[model samples]
Target: MKAMVYRGPYKIRVEEKPEPIIEHPNDAIVKVTLAAICGSDLHLYHGMMPDTRVGMTFGHEFIGVVERVGPSVQNLQPGDRVMVPFNVYCGSCYFCARGLYANCHNVNPNATAVGGIYGYSYTCGGYDGGQAEYVRVPFADVGPARIPDWMSDEDAVLLTDAMSTGYFGAQLGDIVEGDTVVVFGAGPVGLYAARSAWLMGAGRVIVVDHLEYRLEKARTWAFAETRNFAEYDDIVVELKRSTGHLGADVAIDAVGAEADGNFLQHVTAAKLKLQGGSPIALNWAIDGVRKGGTISVMGAYGPIFSAVKFGDAMNKGLTLRMNQCPVKRQWPRLFEHIRNGYLSPSEIVTHRFPLEHIAEGYHTFSAKLDGCIKTLIVP
Candidate 1:
């Protein structure tokens, strides 16, 4: 099997690796048909995440055909076409029973925080991801769902992470009808969050980013007002001015570790590895939202302290809600939305790479070249 192996920071290559086999009674070996390079994967590519060992494959958003299933995997068979959520969990755990599968206590040894995530790092449970021809899925019955007959492979793959997380961001916001929501970042998650805000009854949506291309996508695809943070002297002030000086009703941080607005924060977090992740987006979110509003954080961050505006959030009485999205929890509504033509997840896809050229795919995406919004790898 050929898989993308991480050698070091900014280094990855497609190489022959041993095929995965069922290791647990609830496991299934999936032959990956479609996989996506998520924006969060760049954290590993750039050495932002801790304990991302060399030779580990990095990918979480994927869909596949089950080639073999363990005896305990009763819900699926060898020939089932399935979409596996990024989370790896046991369904009967205390957290899982409460629909908090992303925090399942029975999966990751380091269950103090996030549960097992496919191909994230040792901190999130060192599970191999599906950035290859084959991947072993643990707790297969709980995580892998059969792809709906009406769904396309591209859409199914994106739903595994990006779309689901975006919707979860909006869900966390608890947007009231006619509320103004501002989303920071215009990546796939940001775009989806902006779009989902509308579905949640937000009267207006604003997407903030530095890239013109992504901001354009925010305007067209998400139907949200766009702002280039680079163009503003102070983005929070600009957001406040745009929202009639009170601030937005809700703000979401969709850009995590690599946020670029504050040069010092970016350097401290991304370049120097000082804090967990740059809190520029989150701080902007806190400052951009009105008093007593909500702030939803869907961005991926490391398990370390970040210099955030906790004092200001407390002063303003903001409701801060966030989690590594319970991907399967959002599937039912997402399936309905896709079925009704409300969303075409694949429309965000801008590049496709063969398994052999995954390095090129990573480079293109990491560099944000060729107008790449989303890149898919066909294995």
Candidate 2:
């Protein structure tokens, strides 16, 4: 099998590797058909995440055909086409029973925070991810779901992470009808969050980003107003002015570790590795939302100290909600939305790469070249 192995920061290559086999009674070996390079994957590529070992594959959003299933995997068979969520978990755990699959206590040894995530890092349970020809899925019965007959492979792959997380961000906002929502970052998650906000009855949606291409996508695909944070002297003040000086009813941070705009923050967090992630986007969310409004954080950050505005949040009485999204929890409604033609997840796909050229794919995406919004890898 050929897998993308991480050698060091900004270094990855497709190398021949041993094929995965069923390792547990509940495991399944999946032959990956489609996989995506998520925005969060860049964290690993750039050495932002801790304990991302060399030779580890980095991918989480993938869909595949079951090559083999263990005896205990009763819900699926060898030939089933399935979409696996990013989180690896045991369904019967206390957190799983409460629909908090991302925080399942029985999976990761370091269950003090996030649960097992495919291909994230040692911190999230050193599970090999589906960035290759084959991947071993643990707790197969709980995580892998058969792809709906009506869904396309591209759409199914996105549901594994990006779309699901975006919808979860909107769900966390608890948007009231006619509320104004501003989303920071125009990546896949931010675009989906902006689009989902409309479905949740937000009167207005605004997407903020530095790139013109992504802002254009926000306007056309999400049907929302767009703002380039680079254009403004102070984005929070600009947001407040746009929202009639009271600020938006809700604000979401979809840009995490590599957020630009604040020079010192980006340098200290991304370059110096001083904090978990840059607090620019999260701080913008706090400042852009109204005093009593909500702030939803869907961005990926490391498990370390970050200089966040806890004092301001408390002073303004803001409801700050954040977590690694429970991907499977959003599947039911997403399936319905896709079936009804309300969303075509494949539309966001801007590029595709073969497994052999995954390095090129990573370079293109990391550099934000070719107007790349989303890039898929066909194994």
Candidate 3:
């Protein structure tokens, strides 16, 4: 079997690995059909995710067809097409019972971590992910859902992370009917966040980013009002003006920490840098929002500390919330929506590549070239 292995920073290789089999009675073997690169994968690719450097398969969001099922897997059968949830969890844990399946105690013993994540570290329950010709899926019966016959893998793969995380950002922002929302960054996740805000009945969605392509893309989605940071004097002021000077009911830091490298990047950076999990966006989000607004950070974050102004974030009376989506917890409802045609994540996937062309896909996605909103790795 061939797998894309993450050896170190900016390094990936297609290497031969042992064919996966049904390892446990509760496990199933998936013959991967399609997979997609995620913004979260960029952290590992850039060597920013400390514990995930080596010994990882390098993909989390994927869709595959079940080739073999465990003896105990009653609901799912071979030949079933399913979207594998990023986080693997047993259904009966204390955390799962409370609907916090991402933080399942049995799957991930670490209190600091949520659910055991695929392609991540042991802290998240080191499970094999669906980034290869074959992958072992433990607890497969719990969350895998069949892809509708009408849906293509290319159309469904992007939903695994982009839509889920985007919706996660909106949920974190406490979206409500007629709420004014400001989403920072125009990456795929940010685009989805803007859409999620609208889906949740937000009055206005203002997206701030320097990329003209993304701003234009957001406009096509009717994602709030778009702002190109490079073309604006003060996004906060502009957002206020657009929102009747109330600021936004929600100012979300979807940029996470790395969307801008330093505070200068907030307004005056001379070059474009890949922004994933930068801390500067936090303070900017705090300053950009209303006094009582919420600042939700759906970007992938590490434990390492970054510099921020306590006085501003505190005095502004802002609420802060950050987390990876408890994807399994939302799968049933979200899948239902997808099945019912209420959600169309396919609009975000503008790029696709075969497994061998992954490097080019990464470069294009990383560079955000030619309006490359999202990329899929067709296995």
Candidate 4:
């Protein structure tokens, strides 16, 4: 079998590897039909994440047909088309019972992490990922959601992770009817945040990003108002001005890094108070929120850590939540949404390349060429 293997940072290669077989009583073997690269994969590419081991496959978002199932796996059987949630969790755990599958006791025995990410790193469990010809889906009965008869494989692929993350961010942001929400970054996740916010009945959704292609793409096709981060002299002021001086009801930091601004002034904002330009995205989110509103974040982090202005956050009575996303909890809801035809996540896919041209697909996607947001690898 052929698989895309991670040799090291910035060194992913397509190589021949043995096919996967069931190793657990609850495991199932899936013949991958569709798999998409995720932003989280970038962490592995950049060597920013510590858990990514060499020679491992590195993708989590995919939909496939069951080639075989473990004897204990009864809910899903041969020929069943399904999407694998990014996490590999047992449904009976304490966290799973409370709908916090990310922190599942059965999945994350290390207790250092909350959720299991496919091909991410050993930190999350060194599970093989879906960026291959076949994948061994552990705990399939609990983690796999059935793809609908009406949806295509490409459309159902994102229900595994990216869409679920966006939905989680929106749910945390408290998107309600008539509320205005601002989302930072127009990447795949951010665009989905805008979409999810709209589905939750938000009155207005604003997507912010510096990339002209992404900004235009979000506005034109995704149905969200957009702002170019590069054009805004001050995003917070711009958003407030746009929202009639009251700011937005909820602001989401879909961009993990801080943008340029008055960060030095409030250097001591927390204990350091760094103020003026504290990562414009978070600042914009903090400032954009209306009084007593929420600020949600879905961007991956830890490469660079900054001092947060807890006092400022507290002053506005803001609520903050950030994570790798509790995909297990959102899988069923996202599946229902897809079945009902409310959100089509596959629209973000701009380029497709055969498995033989995997290298080329990586180049185009990494460069963000010609409105490319998400790229899929076909085997």
Off-target runs (Cα >4 Å) in candidate 2 are 261-272, 304-306
Q: Model 3 Cα displacement at 153 (Å)?
A: 2.3
Clashing pairs in 2: none
Better-scoring candidate (TM-score), 2 or 3: 2
Clash totals for all candidate models? 0, 0, 10, 23
lDDT of 4 at 154: 79
What are the RMSDs of all candidates, in order? 1.2, 1.2, 3.7, 4.6
Q: What is the TM-score of each candidate against the true structure?
A: 0.98, 0.98, 0.90, 0.89
lDDT of 4 by residue, 263-283 (tens): 443243222322212355776
In model 3, where is the ten-residue run with the lowest total lDDT?
A: 267-276
Instruction: Estimate every model's Cα lDDT from 0 to 1.
Output: 0.92, 0.93, 0.76, 0.78
Residue 98 lDDT in candidate 3: 79
Error of 2 at 100 (Å): 0.3
Measured by TM-score, how close is model 1 to the native structure?
A: 0.98
Candidate 4's TM-score: 0.89
**Cα RMSD of predicted structure 4:** 4.6
Clash pairs for candidate 1:
none
- Show where candidate 1 strays beyond 4 Å: 261-272, 304-306
Determine the backbone clash count of candidate 2.
0
